[model samples]
Target: MPTITGFDYRRVPVAEDVSLNVAVGGSGSPIVLLHGFPQTHLMWRHVAADLTADHTVIVPDLRGYGDSDKPSGGYAKRVMAADTVALARALGHERFALAGHDRGALVAFRAGLDHPAAITHLACLDVLPTLDMWDVMRGTTAAVGFHLYLMAQPPGLPERLIAGAPDAFFGHFLDLWANDPSAIPPDVRVAYLDACRNAIPSIVADYRASAGIDADHDQADRDAGNRLRMPVTVLQQDWGAALGYDAVALWRAWASDLKHETVTCGHFMAEEAPADIVKSLRALLSR
Candidate 1:
């Protein structure tokens, strides 16, 4: 195992020509952590280390981010979720607890919905379902979420425009979303910017899927009145209170049994407040 100062990190092959950078530690039932946009598996460094004493931890960069293979297609949450499932299986686990942040949270949502039998529990940080997210953003709130529209633009344009200054584009969210700018250490911020700069096309493709294919999947589930069967927990900043949107109600509609709360932190809850995240996960798992 290659040691990175305080942590042990290694690359694991999840599929042919595709590998996930994973950090494993601790001992117990598996708990897989998925990181958000523009960030590698490193985002979970703190949280994973915290849980290692009591649980087996698996942290992976999503298919198109970090050290993971940046495949040209299949950026949809459903497909990305499958990659996670395969990764877990390849690592010798048939079932595991799962948690994700931002874009990764969307992938977790799909995994719980599409692969209910594979996920024992699901935790989503600072995100809502694609359809509910679209429904909640109206008027001024929509403006706050303008990135959705920008990224949803014709593929090449958004990618090209964002590529020009990837740091600025990715950093805008980090600054605006974090309640404390100091929450993200300088080195991690640089790593995030560098990764985002290189993976502009894949990042754009992931968002485009949300606007088109992901919307269709959410709508189909809504039309079918589908609901998640496992224990589900959602922790998010009060975007609803800030924008006058009913966040809990929207989430409850999708999760039959859920524990939803708004934490008094920024969008990057894991990094901003790892203690709260760990507390929430422990409580959710206990149930």
Candidate 2:
């Protein structure tokens, strides 16, 4: 099993009753990396290890995911983004680079909009903003994101249904969403599965927020003239071609300075293509 070596781990409180499981390493300008769905901070093992050579790497399992506190509420991306800012500040960084994959990417997008002054640079992998995502996911094409609809339903059923056979349900994505499943070695895959299994309700709550409050919050931002002020990079699989929309154009509405690339790999780009992701982050940092 490849762990994030040389990084010290700690439980840092970002709220009254919520503390995040954080892993910090290296020393330089800071960059906080947030993990996506069905995985924990361990998803950044490859990218974090490489960046630790010159940058302060802050990796944390979002409050509901990994080893972090899983409260009944506060799963909204706005709140989650606030949790991230507090986590960074609690660790002595007032402003830093921010990057996220999947759900984390949504949170990062919110953070960029909500705390523009606090995020010097931003990167989002494999997600559209909450509003854009709901807008574009229409008709039969939306069937590909069945899980999104499943979790978005009013609580009880989604939680009980997923909890029934967590592995089979979560494993379905782990199996299908990757272009290179081998990239996730056996232990890492097991780690992801274990984490997802234990966090079903909170995970569902996280997704549920995306359907409700997260989307409403995004719509509010869109109603205003708010947009990301910092340099931004978005890397995603060519979903537009399949889903019927321009990915770059969609992102352009949200970011003033944007670099959107259509990656060839699957949705789990950070783990599936870390070298390409690292290069993009370094390039974004340079700008």
Best by TM-score: 2
- TM-score (all chains, Cα) for each model: 0.95, 0.98
Instruction: Report lDDT (Cα) of residue 198, candidate 1.
Output: 79
Error of 1 at 100 (Å): 0.9
Q: Which 10-residue window in model 2 sums to the lowest lDDT?
A: 1-10
Worst 10 residues of 1 by lDDT: 1-10
Off by over 4 Å in 1: 1-7
Write down the TM-score for model 1: 0.95
Model 2 has how many clashing residue pairs?
A: 0
Quantify all predictions' global Cα lDDT against the true fold. Answer: 0.86, 0.94
For model 2, residues 90-149, the per-residue Cα lDDT tens digits are 999999999999999999999999999999999999999989999999999999999999
TM-score of 2: 0.98
